[model samples]
Each structure stands twice: as C-alpha cells, then as structure tokens.
Target: MPEPARDPRLKSLINQLQPGPVRKVKVIGFDGVDVLVQLMDAEGEEAEIGRIPLYEASMRRMDNPSELFELGQEISAEEIGRWREGQLHLSARACEIPALRSFLLSIERRQIVTGTVSEVHNFGVFVHLDGEPDGLCTGFIRVPDLTWTRMNHPSEVVAPGHRITAEVIIAETRSGQVTLSLKALREDPLIRFADQIGRVLTGPITKIIPFGVFVQLAPGVEGFLHLSELTDEPGETSDRLVDEGELITVRVAEVDLQRHRVRLCAADGEGGF
Candidate 1:
C-alpha cells in the first residue's frame, strides 16, 4: 500500500524544528498555560516574541510554569517551530539539560545505540541510555518493538540492568526521548515463513480471542484461523469446536508481510482447525 502524503505545513514544521538550534530567551510573563518570552539576540538584546507552552517548560512534570521560570529570568531554549498563528514556539525542556539536548541531537534514525535496561513494564521498557545526561532515562522500547515474536510479558525478553543494543526508531527532542527497537536488529520470522504458504501443517492452538484462535506453526510464527473457518456449520463458535493446546491441521492461506499476519484455513477433510 502507498504511504499517505504528509501535510505540507506539518512537513515544513518538522523540517524547521528537527536539528533545531538552541536560543536565549527571557521570560516576560505567563499567559494561562503559556510562558511569554522575548527572544534574545547574540548581544543579549530582545528580538522577537516567543511562547513556551507549559508542557515545554521543563522535562519534569509541574503544575505551573512559575515552578521553573521567574519573570525576566534569562534561560536557554530551542526554537521548535511556530504555532498556526505565527507565534514562535520554544521548548525549554529540550535545552534544560545541555547534555540531553546534545545527546538527542547526536543520534539518528536506524543508528545503533546501547543502553542498560532500567525498568520493564507491561507497556514498555525504559533504558538509561549510555551517553544520556546524568539522572535521565531517555531510551524506551514499546512492547511491540521489543521483539518480533509473541510474548506474554517484556520480562521474558529483558530484565533490569541488562545491557542491550537497539536501532533508534526516533530521537524526539520534544519528548526528551529516544525510541529504540530491539527487533529491528533481528530477522522477521514472518518473512521466512512466507515461502511456506499453501503447505499443510499441524500445530497447537495457542490462544483463542473473540475473532479466532492463533495456531503456532513454528516458534514465533503463528497463523490466525478465523472463527468462520473453524467449521462449515453456521452458528458454531470457536470455543465449542476447539480448545487451547489442541493440535489441529491447517493450510497456510496467506501471509501478509507488511502487516506481519498469517491467515489459516482448516485442512482438507478436517471439520475445524
């Protein structure tokens, strides 16, 4: 499938913001959720007006902009593109820690980065990137990006304090984060299994969702047998026809490489699989 075109304005904004340069700005005042500021030139003279949204004020969460900045306080921030109204937008969080900004700017997409796993949660894994600023954990691997294989939990693949190398998916200065992917370094199992389409295979039912059951054809390779494919008889639910761990014969119907999905159908002479 063709990729969607990006909005011209957004594309322009990204091009302008990425690899952005840090600038000096003095807080003029607070406007509700925004911090009004005056851009400072090299000579420390005020130039243009800039605004820092509350969320961009600091890397740490805070209830108010006043928590970090005071009136007329000179601070450093990166020019993060302009709002729709042409108001200059700045990110204090991006430059709040000089080391972090340098680290985020130095990394590139698909670059190999090493880090120590600091936490493992159901949603993702957090890492203390090797070159990141002190006391900051910037590397993160989302659950799906951890590996290509199906897993019950992230702990199955990595534990706290484990050193790992991953490919950088993105280095977002706005979020002060580097999204890493361990599976990008490994071969996709589905790509290897694609050649096996149309072959008859017998495997155990690993899981049964509302739509169908997942049959493990190979380690890390599972095929989805839709509930409708379970039996020719209408009104027969999957639970009534099959049980988890039950070996069932199926034919590989399709393998979607882009989507990383495998479709299966019951083998000939089999009522359900």
Candidate 2:
C-alpha cells in the first residue's frame, strides 16, 4: 500500500530522526516552547524522546519546562478543539465549489445590477452586490470608464454606497475578479454631440496660456485652439488674443474619441481652418 502523503513540517522531522513506534513527544526550554515529537515504541519503559537541542533554544523564554510539558499534554485537547472549529471554516470555504458554478447565477449580459459602490480608487471603482458575501460581487471601475469628463480624482465619479449599474466587462473564474464599466451603463453624450463637430460650438474659455485656450466642448472633451491657430486682428499678438471665460467660437476641426481630444480652428472661419 502507498504511504499517506505527509506535511513538509512533519516530513522534515521524520527524515531527521526515524519514528521508532509512533509516540507523540513535546519538550520545553528557555526562549519559548515547542513540540518535540516522534512515533515511539511502547514495548519497553518508554524512553524519553531524543531532543533537537537547537530546537529547544526557542523555548528559552518558557523558563519552565514543566509548564510546556503541561501544555504539550494538553495538545491533544487544544489541537482537537481548534481543529473542530477549523473544520467548520474549511467546510465553508470548500463548500463553495466555484468550478461547478456558472458565471452568472441567472442574469443576462448587460443586465443592470444596482450594487453599492465600494473602495473608489484613483483609477477604478469597486462595486459590491447587495446582501451577498462581501467577497462575492465587488468589482473594479476604471476612472476613465466612469464618465465623459476629465477626472482629477475618482471620488468625483463614485462614492461608497452609491448605487450604480455597471456593465460586467468580464466575469471569469481565472481572476474571479469582475471588471465593471459605468460608462457603458450610461448614455454617451459624445454620440449626441457629434453633430456639433462641423458646426462651431462656443463655450467659456476655461483655460488659457501661451499654448492655447481650452474650451469645454463637452463635459469631458475639450478643444485646443492653438496660439498659431488663433487669427490675428490687425497687429494683435497671440498673447493679447484670448482670455479664459471669454466666449470663443472655435470650429471643431477634428473629433478624436480615441485620444479623447478635439482639434479646433478660430471662429472667423479664417487661419486656414
């Protein structure tokens, strides 16, 4: 018959000194206390188990070997009780046979789940399904995927306890980690605002510098009306050109969804738009 597999900790001890007759041994010394055990024969006056002197150094703090011997004697009692409690925990974790379970308990793709937002991060939002194990339905929502607006921080888009319907981008066992998409759950303004591209859309110049003016084209999307792109009025230098919050009607020259930026031309319909 094949021998039962052994824990490495037990194996190491067995390899060092052969088990003579399978008797459990425990020893104590100064540093602290530990178990010194072996399978010993009961045939004779059971000889004291051999000591790994170095191993006993850890028991130096124990100061009383008799006390540790008392503790060792109680091992059969304490270990058994602990194992009984551990058995419940083990069964609970093991009973969840994920391999036999389906990804969706019973939901369609794109189905909205009103889950509470949790652990909002600079890059992602985590959501937890209601009433399930805390480990069950919590997932991530990347900052970029949260809204159409440029996010200086993730907290702006999500907060703990915020009920949100995030699309399940991935629900696989490999990671067992869910990838959520809040943007997919919401209506896209870009799609509706796409028509404003050919026509000039004017908004406050929220930012201005030597580079150009950043006009809010949409909540998130903005156009850079370059210093060179601004038409000069008579001898007006580019520096004297535009101030922030000044109404600017720059033609949306290009709409770049991939880069999340827009190209613009001066409102005068000139400057080689």
lDDT of 1: 0.86
- Candidate 2 deviant stretches above 4 angstroms: 1-109, 208-210, 218-221, 231-243, 257-260
> How many Å off is the CA of 184 in candidate 1?
0.9
TM-score of each: 0.87, 0.52
**lDDT of candidate 2 vs native?**
0.53
What are the Cα lDDT values of the candidates?
A: 0.86, 0.53
Which candidate number would show the highest TM-score if scored against the true structure?
Answer: 1
Q: Judged by lDDT, which candidate is best? A: 1
lDDT of 2 by residue, 85-190 (tens): 3330001111123331234333334556567887777767777754344446546677777886665788987789888877755442222345567887665555
What is the TM-score (0 to 1) of candidate 2? Answer: 0.52
> What is residue 184's positional error in candidate 2, in angstroms?
1.4
